[model samples]
Target: MAGTNVLFTVIVILIYNAYTIDSISTANLEASLDEYINAGLKCHTKNPGLALAIVKDGKVILTKGYGVRDLSTNSPVTDRTIFGIASMSKAFASTLLVKLLAKHSNMSIYTDIAKILPNFKFTTHIRTDNANIRDLLSHTMGFPAHNLMRLDPKLTRDDIASRSQQVHSIHPFRDSYLYNNLMYGLASVVAERIGGKRWEDLIEEELYTPLGMSGSSFMTKVDLSGNVAKGYGTDDATGGPVPIDFAINRRWGQMGGSTNIMSNAVDISKWMLFHLSKGRNQAGQQILSENDMATLHRRRNTITAPTSEKYFSQPQVPVSSLEENYALGWKNGVYRGYKVLRHTGTTWGYSSLVTLIPDMNLGFFTTMTGDDPGYKFRYLLHNYIGDLLLGETPWLNKTTLCSFPEPWYNQSTSVYHPINKHINPTRSLNYYVGVYHNSMYGNLHVTMNTSANTLQMNYGIGSWLLYPKGTHDKFVGEGTNIVHKIIDLSSIQFHSSNLHGRSTIDSVKVISFETRAPPVFTKTSSHVNTGNIVG
Candidate 1:
């Protein structure tokens, strides 16, 4: 939520080594790909399963799977093996939205969200009130990533819509990209409001059914067919891959259009073909206009991270660096000088990377199971494939990427004190027990855990055990689990304010809620239902 997910700052830009299109024989292409991929699986990626699908010149060129689907079963991954593609599902949301817009003359991409869903609002900061569908699609809606909002129990699309008013807009409207998942869910809320249909049903009718993506469905239900791949993550203690629980374990039902779409390479190939053919159906009719498709694919928002010209101190890979920008669903940019649109997604135990070169009518979709925190394997293979197809010698490989150290995102950060474990609280635990509420964030409960003789913070996202930090009133939360894996739970600082006449702890700040501006929940009351606290 704070910075780039998986990106590498190459040392220097390389010259485009343009070779003849026929330089690599067609017969050798598949063999070469298999050899390279198999080597990658063995060398550094170490994924349990991976599926790849490629579309070119309006045809499905390749559908292949390698390795076992899960470590427990030893069942080999097939071309049809199902894997969860996380945020890549965003493209489907935006595409379905565009198709819906085609039927409704009253609604357009430029329409303000408030017009479609009257109750929807964003922080009353008038600057953010006028945000339209395009802003949501492109993630330029001004709100920084408020991921914790999605953790509410049995949250509906309406709840997400209602909560937008609470989250402050920290970024510029329609200028900088914020990459918000909740905003996408809020956009889907708008879609359902105007289309008079659930976002799931709308996509199934307009996109999936027509594209013949029979195996693709929302992640809420488990496929009884017994073909689903298990999710994974690396264990911090062992630094080895571990089988993580499903999204269901953490209430995936609350996720609307933001994420959780289960699909196989076969179904996703049809999806790729839809974009490659400019939204044409099998019947040779346009589902969406070429201009609309272009608009969806065109770069609308600029961002830092991989898109910005920044250098990190490390041994680097030689890649062609070019200016890049974010489009609606995909990151519209260049890979080795080829105009490209791409996106990568990672969930509990699955990761996916997709690339599309519209000029060449080429698209690549690769998804894998197991832990890939840095996603180096996916990026390495994406660039390698781009090199092979572009007729240039491949420069990216496992040795170059895997050699770098994986980032440690657990530690909390602050300029004054990263953490002062030596600090201790001066007051009794009972004084801190209360309900702190942020208008946009709703409420967080702090209650006495008499059994443990400690303070427990109850939020929709996590149940944190609070302990003193040496001498300061500020305490740190120990969170072993979270709504989503990536959220970093940090210091919980209690502020003293005047109540009647004497000073008391009146507000508590969750320092990790937002990196730039932490959500300070005021003490609404010291009374709360301890039974309502959940993990």
Candidate 2:
């Protein structure tokens, strides 16, 4: 018996030694990733925080948090700390659509959207007649991010989709690729119609519970408590981020199925793992058939060539970098000879990224709370990880950081636009104070701030102070708006003292304004007159 015991002990020691050696190799790989991620994040000292998770072989292998989640409490971010995942929510909606399509043999990904939602007719039909569920998911329906409609929580998904007719398509349907949120909202309405429930309810029942993503939520019942990270924005002048308030945060609920999903890295890893498993839930249930999975992952629309000379003039990713296309809910591209699936989401104070390399059996999820004007750090970190995992050369270094665009406002220029600092208002500030209306967007109310001596403008989920730009009827405004982008307007004008002007982003005019009668608030006055006010 004693001899047998000694032999057993020896065998255990041998097994332990072998496991230790293997763990040592794994630890080195993890350490490399840690250093690489931290180094990439070091440049953004103003960033409120970040949470990251990496999955391999259907398991979470690396999970971490960096920086402060709340500056006031100096709390560190944790795996469970929630951040607004923004457009990443689209994948969940897409997955749900796939599930619904499978359950209802009558429906198909190629089913025309107009057939599903007859009410979703555009004012001037272009190729909308040919639009389908796949078109909405792939963003080939010919509309550029018309995000202004996503600011009013009061607007239902149907109301938002109805306004799609009011906006013109920048490209012919299926002729050009343009990112759109309204299309996703329209898709959700179609999903609701097919599923006989609210889009959020369908998502919660079909995706969240099945995947065990307890930390995820749609438009309602957001749990920002218990380790949830607060959203924040930066001021280039102060060189730090300030906590965002309800005025801007409210838009998260109004984005419909487009961008409103709040989740943490811990739960998000499950989502990545599900995709890595080719659309199988942990319970061994095939959430989507292999064919449907193929449909979801297959490239449905070829996007602009990344290497086209037209893109060379200030392109986000080099065309030669990767031949890319839009898969159902993922951006499909080639990275270092591997099929790369990825998506990015941005809100006013948070940014998120999810990447999957199915060939390597690896997946990654990261979310950051920052006001990065270009939101490049998320991608930089993503690229560095992809390079490291693929065993490529260290192409990203301190110098690589120089390629990122500067924050919209930087130290050299004034951060907070001082009221009338650059140019004084030619007329009294009160001249610009009035109610502006657009049929698509509910209202914009401008009022004279007596204390600040600036004209304050309030619209769906945002408020900004307009300062004179030294031009008659033209004013400049600078601030972050509700849809999570910076507002740098130079042509905000008041033609005929009625506050008529246009606001643009990326050189595309997205919103127009004009004076209208204020909301009549009389006692017992119901239906105080509303009309289709063309913006």
Candidate 3:
């Protein structure tokens, strides 16, 4: 029975695609949107659910939901269902900054971040004073992305900001672009300091309340009272989606500006319409000045073909023909002869995309329960809509550009068959069990799980058990923080031997790796000796 349904869905999708190519009327487009989205979602049959909204010419043309909210109950998702929009929250942060600037009058995007975050520091050689609000919005902060540090539930925004000096930069100040979550978090901190309110409350007061986006908020768990969709993650080995716990509220309090807002398609449509109307409320009152809105949309950084290829590989737009640029909090480029601005967000099991075409006055919002595959589905939906609206050829396919967490966990591990058997550690697990610290990220306590004969490293609020990677001294593991326990696992790699060639019995060297960044840690003067330790 399931097989028959799958075949039927495929056939329907093909027919709809053919119709969409020929259709030109807005009525026709609206009529086929449900089928179009359903067809795109067929590739992610195991995903828990999804909700989408399309806004055109200052009004919502379509808002719908697909699949079940949860696998166990089979509860269908509705237009009102809430899901974490992840980095989509960045635009909200950007908007808040613009709004604050309008009120302050004296402030500008060029205002030095030091004015807001007095304690922010950079490495000695770098000109920390040159850093300003614009750098944070355009992601030209010059520092590498250090997302792992932001995953700690215990660390406040101030804690992360104070340690900025500890994070090394790959590019010289304002010379290149690096997508950064910490910078966005810092932007919110600046807003809090200026607006005299929590980031969440400021958003509510300045934007959500006025726009009537009652369904949207930074409170992930509190949003559950509504019809919220359960998030799911794709298993790298099996390519199957499974339920992931929604622990977003715990860690998002401080990082809310980067990836914490929760909202439904219905509410997000209002946001889209607001942007389409150029930041005016329904009453025609200017909520944000037109000049400020334009500032938010102004291209601040140019993204070359190489960076696009490096970040989002296949299924992405050919970087050679089109130029991509980053604005304050949005990504803009030309698509099918129309000016396009879009951004994608991933938080644990949920993924989101918001695209705006100012020329056509069209906007799209999509949210789904899965990781990388969900991203694929989003791009598919965006392309399909774009093709129909722009009267272009159906260009996006299964191979569309998709992104996953760093240290991408794929099926590569399964390819190497065991030669003999798993190798054990050189010394007892206790030798690795110690508190290692990094100035920027704080302490990661490695403890011996005697019962399991394994070593577990705890970073702030989450912990993961380590296992031999290729060698016993070098270990690799995957786990999430205590807060959002979303199935999208953060990976970690550990090394015990001194890569620096300086190790003592009481103070062994340790290296910790997470996704794209690596931080080295050395044992403290004291060590916890478990009886299991052996030379």
Candidate 4:
């Protein structure tokens, strides 16, 4: 009886000590936040809204929202204000697939994609399913970003999974990192086949419910209703960010596991704490062992593609960062002496950053409505919080990093010319009109508007005016609709193939549709021939 009483006293004392420690940590963070957070967010006054959550030593130090949720209503954002988290949703999918794999213990991570997924047909130099879940999650599958597949707004997960057979290789198989979202979406498709549940439900049941993220979901405005923040995009002409249509939110929901989790900072703080823990739920049940967690965070592919160099450049990267890698749904790197697991997510107008330092038990999540700030603001805020917690001096005074992110972006995106300017087509508009097709990307139907005397592309995408370039066959696409800032319009060149002494456009080269080598769509039907096409 005496021993039992002593044990109860000890447990009480331990709980008190933990409470005291958390309180102290919270006080310190609150005291430092006013100056740090306000200064860091000074430049984004024009932005619609944003939310942030910071976790340290398995405690939520802060969860805050800044600015208005909607421009017209002027409703201030709160910790619980829902926002689209974009690719940060990847980690949840990764965990779900891992859990599903554990349930089916016989299945290996190295199990061929063909054998695991139902009728998997991701074609490559090797066998169709030679690449496994690891390759898809790590993004070393050699396929470029066939992002056009997601634009249709009608394709299902099953449709996406089957269409993978059509996308050809741009990089060497298992030899390069390409950051393919479609492949990750396919991973969820694999999970569904093995687990007998839809990707949405599996994530809700397995990850969100376990983590106490009750407010998270695949939001389409209809899901969250009143609480969702409107997304915003930058307009170069207006020189300020504008609120994007709320209807655009529904498009990503159908795109599978790549990016469709809408959540709040308050709930995400719980997610940060979960990672800081030993993969145990609030009920103390072990969902993932330490080894399982390590596997999820394990470094797999090094990110070193030439176009990827912009990520490693200065001012934007964390201080003392040494190398970067792609793990299962996470970017693995070391910033200073602490290990960093991070990912930046941009879903149309919304953008987010999820950073975790497991060894230090520190992480931060930032979600914003506007695309103007991009990676710069998120990077600055995380570094500021990390510096405050680590007892380190501000390397560039924090606000300095946040002040002028525009110049850095200008330097990064200077590779391509602005699409605002257009040159006249080399021949008549009818000569360039055709029904172009790529088995992987589907179809692109080009038609001429006789009234306007301009050619239009009906790639199942928005209305794109084909503005000629270089006084020749080359042309640039300009989206007529303002909301589709996600689509590229920089370069589309027409190639002529002569047959029977007549010149006809046989192919349309897409230079900037998130494609690596910029794939070419062969002309299957021509407007000049009317009924007959090149085929």
Q: What is the C-alpha RMSD of each candidate to the true structure, in Å?
A: 7.7, 9.5, 9.4, 6.2
- Candidate 2 local lDDT, 396-504, one digit each (tens): 6554554443322132444464445556767676555555555566555566656667866555555566777787656655553442234444446555512246321
Candidate 3 lDDT by residue in tens digits, 346-424: 7777888888888667888888887753254566577667776656665543334221222232423334232222557
lDDT of 4 at 328: 88
lDDT score, candidate 1, position 118: 67
lDDT string for model 1 (59-84, tens) is 78788898888888888888888888
**Pairs of colliding residues, candidate 3:** 247-483, 247-484, 314-401, 315-400, 315-401, 316-401
Best by TM-score: 4
Q: lDDT score of model 2?
A: 0.67
Q: Assess the local accuracy of residue 518 in candidate 2 as a C-alpha lDDT between 0 and 100.
A: 16
The reply for model 3, stretches above 4 Å from the true place, is: 1-27, 304-323, 393-421, 470-472, 478-517, 525-535
Q: lDDT of all the models against the reference?
A: 0.72, 0.67, 0.69, 0.72
Displacement of residue 93 (Cα, Å) in model 1 is 1.2
**Per-residue error (Å), model 1, residue 461:** 5.0
- Structural similarity to truth (TM-score) of each candidate: 0.85, 0.80, 0.83, 0.86
- Model 1 bad stretches (over 4 Å): 1-27, 43-46, 125-129, 248-253, 307-316, 321-323, 404-427, 448-453, 481-488, 498-503
Error of 1 at 313 (Å): 12
Which regions in candidate 4 have their CA more than 4 angstroms from the true location? 1-28, 125-129, 219-224, 246-249, 305-318, 372-374, 404-422, 450-452, 482-486, 527-535
Q: Could you tell which candidate, 2 or 4, scores higher by lDDT?
A: 4
Instruction: Please give, for residues 439-475, the per-residue lDDT of candidate 4 as tens digits.
Output: 7666777888666567777555355777777746887
Task: Give per-residue lDDT, candidate 2, residue 486.
Answer: 45
What TM-score should be assigned to candidate 1? 0.85
